[model samples]
Target: MQADSDPVTSGMIRRLLRLVLGSKGYDLPFKSDTDRNFLLLLVALMSFLAVLACAGTLTLHAMTQRWSSGLENKITIEVKAETPNGEILSPESVKLDTEKIAGMLEGNLAIKSYQVMNEVEIKKLVSPWIGEDFSFDEIPMPGLIAVELSAATPETLETLTQKVLSVAPSARIETHREWLQDILRFVKTLQGLAFLVAMIVVVTTITAISSGVRSRMAIYRNQVEILHLIGAPDPYIARQFQWHAVIVSLLGSVIGTAAGLAVATLIFHLSGKDETALIPEIGLNYGQIAAFIILPLLACLISGTTARFTVLRTLSQMP
Candidate 1:
């Protein structure tokens, strides 16, 4: 019902005609729209993509929250087998450096606690790569310290770095936040891509609806011309397109959404409920479930509106 004149008033008037026509008043043979099934297939595929994209966006959003909180206010110290002056040190030196780092942590009021992982733990970490029997006595192994802080501010991190460097300049201090930052950025990029795909789905659905409307109009041109000859308003003709499009789109959307969620549920179960799964138990909440349910209904409304506008425009151009 868009117009060279007022769009709102014209839309209202067209809708009034549609209401007056009800479901029974049409001069055109509704069965003559040969592209109906094709349009439904296209709409169904687009709606499926829309649902998956939304689910991905929501899942990644949840991952961001879980991952960020994991590293909050935490840091790690890697005590390598090196001296303050960048010289390789003996295993004894590395252990002494680790002990010094631990002592520093114990004395610092800002640190809540720290654990210097034993040689057995270090050996266990390396065993998967170099074999279980690999002896650390042959090569000086790096030490690790897990530190928990009461509060980790810029000044606190700076002070901790200085203290570690004083003991062993080669020691590496990690707040464990760099990896988390990279993960968050990657997740954000994925979320953006999902949103972009959803928008593409919307545009594609509208395009499909428009194509169906025009194709039907072309196939029934003689009947439409006779209606024009009889002095029927364009709105009266447009309602036929509007309701048919709505019914077709509604059916497509329901099929697509149900299929999409079914696939999602299958994948979710395959991902396993492993408590150790990095992504957490990825499942839709009530809100997300409701959104999927609402998506098909929205498709109905959009297709109907697109059909109305396409008719008004196409009929105005016809002789």
Candidate 2:
């Protein structure tokens, strides 16, 4: 229990109590002070937790979009022609086939973008495997045309692939269904894990806030006892404790939100690494960034309201 008359302790508690309930705001006969320490601590905790959750969710959403955007309606076609030796093909034939495939793709409404690989580009591609001395002029290097379709069905891709193969007998279309499926599954799993983490943090935070309030209220047992002796109403006493709890939680929320947003900003900043690396979309979108701004306030509201109800319930049995 807190001492009734230690000069420093008395002053601190009085100041805290006043800050919480506000001086002259209530006419309660008992001490009406705010616990500023508790309030600040709670706000910090809430802010961090809220930001962590929001950032995680936003990141997951962005990553999903990235993966989907990459795979959506895209296919690659490989073209090859048999040489006199029958073991290799000519580079010119490969280029011609690629151009023909590109022309075929152009007529279809579903085909949004098509890039035909030429002899020089194909030579460069094969240089990694064949070395610089290898002449793609004499031997056929497989030509590839990267095609992006505009919201086409899987059947449409199949039909397009057949048509291309019929016209360019040496060309083969490779559908990316398996790879796309794997990417989708992975994105979904990441999203689910992020959500689970958020739920766990929220539950842990609520428990911490409740326990802290209970602990602080325990130290006021003597004051509460005096108030009871003087016939103070339970509501009046409960109001003081409730107010204290709300203020404490509000503090934790503020702290938590700040920490969370800072971490998110750092992640966003660091995402500008290698150009070729599959970096997740780390920057916050318009809606998500807006949500982050309000997340701290929402946490304060939730924790404060929850604490008030919890304290009142606990105080209901008091005489």
Candidate 3:
């Protein structure tokens, strides 16, 4: 049995077995390590950015839904400066009108609760735009009331609007539906932009991998041709490049994803501390965290596939 088993044939079988077992037995003797390191760095950066973008999109979507739901059943009633007689109402008259409207809202079955904002509260609301030192007595500020409804419908809203106008003809009723629609549109637009950016990142990553594979193939042209002459199959050669790409991309993406998670965690903690932050409580849920963890595997798959296809295509075009 030992005599029949030729040493050269046994060595070939061992190499093939190693290849099948996912070992890098066919690495070329070229200095491609730097190229691979560069590829890893680029992929890592792209992956990090992609994760942040996805997280932002998801957070914005959640925020939009929460805001929309909260405001859906609420309306704002603005008591204007002018009364029904087209004459400017005094502060006392505006106060009386506000009281009268509050009484009407209390009697209405549609209204769940209503609050006539006091002058101090209105001043606080305008303090951001107009200086706190600005006297409200010198200017006419509309009396504002926030109303919550048990059931907000067209008929209920119309009846409420008419009652408010009768009590204070200059009063304007505003439902949040239109504002919510605008906000939803804006959020969707941002999501679309984020998706576009992600697609660009994916395409750029594939292109980078393909280019690196092509360059490496060029460097190993002589060895590859000798392998082809010796009956080595295209898939075996491609697997060498594919596995390299996979290893490099996986390492880079993992590093990148870790960095991204760190950033997201920091932001979540910081933003949570400040209730007035633009993205308060910006953090991934369990499902989103799972998706984020899958990013590295996806990057590896993409790079491996790109490298294999690029090597095969380049070899096919060779004489």
Candidate 4:
């Protein structure tokens, strides 16, 4: 029983080694495993760039969503009118109009809370942009309401807008929807750019990998010629080169991706506590990180396959 168990354990150990480290079939002219290591380095660099490209796009989307949602529950009401003589309206009449509009809005069910901004509040907002001295008293400014909407149906802003219009025909409703739409448009453009960047990275990476494998094969021409003379099949020779490229690519991808995540983490930590910048920092979040890990393996597989085909096709055409 002990003898049998020893053989079985040895066999299991051998299988495990092969699975993790790959089979050492041929010792090439290049220093021990240099070819595979270089392939991996190439893969890692390209994949790292790919992750950077992906992160940029995702962060932009997250930031846009955050901003849009932040303003999702708030709206502004402005009250203003042109005088009949094509001049600015009287402040007293505007104030009166603002009161009537506020009173009407206060009775609405969709409104969660309402605050009528006095001259002071309006001036406070305008101070930074224009100047502190800017006042509603000096300039015929519109009366504004800072409105918070009910959680159930914030989109029903149209109904509330109509109600305000009924009370004061000249009243204006600015729900931030247009601004949100503009933000969304900007986000969409960013997403488009991200997609384009991702595509370019993939194409460039694939090309780099294919070229590297081809170059490595060219160096191994003499060995391949000897193997062919010794009656080794084309498939066998292809398999060795393919496996070497695959191993290298796989290892490189793993290293590059890990570095990418680490850099993202460092940036996230250094973002300062402002919290207002709202940068969409990177995190794995379980399945998300796993997806990135899987990508490297896929890249390796693709690179290996390309190398295999390129070598076999080239060999087939030769005498």
**Number of clashes found in candidate 4:** 1
Ranking by TM-score: 3, 1, 2, 4
Model 2 agreement with the true structure over 1-319: per-residue lDDT tens digits: 2434433434644566677667743333223334445455655765676576667767767776776777767888888676435755556666777788777888788788888776678777778677778765555568788888887587887788788977787777776777778877877787787778767766765776677556655766677778767887776776765565555554456567767777888877777554545565467766776677676566656666666666676677565
The per-model lDDT (C-alpha) reads 0.80, 0.67, 0.81, 0.71
TM-score of 3: 0.82
Candidate 2 has an lDDT of 0.67
lDDT string for model 1 (82-129, tens) is: 666767788887888889889878878999888899989888777867
Candidate 4 structure quality by residue, lDDT tens digits, 2-52 = 122333323443343357546743434433334455565677887787776
Rank candidates by lDDT, best first.
3, 1, 4, 2
lDDT of 3 by residue, 1-319 (tens): 1222433433443354356545544445422246866887898998998888788788888888788778888999998887567777788788888888988878677889888998899998888788798776787788899999998889989988888988887889989788679878999999999899889989999999999899888878998898877887888788878877776687789889889878987887778898755544667888888888789999989998999999899889866
How many residue pairs clash per model? 0, 28, 0, 1
- lDDT for model 3 comes to 0.81
What lDDT, from 0 to 1, does candidate 1 have? 0.80
Candidate 3, residue 89: Cα displacement in angstroms equals 1.3
Clashing pairs in 3: none
Q: TM-score of the candidate numbered 2?
A: 0.76
The candidate maximizing lDDT is: 3
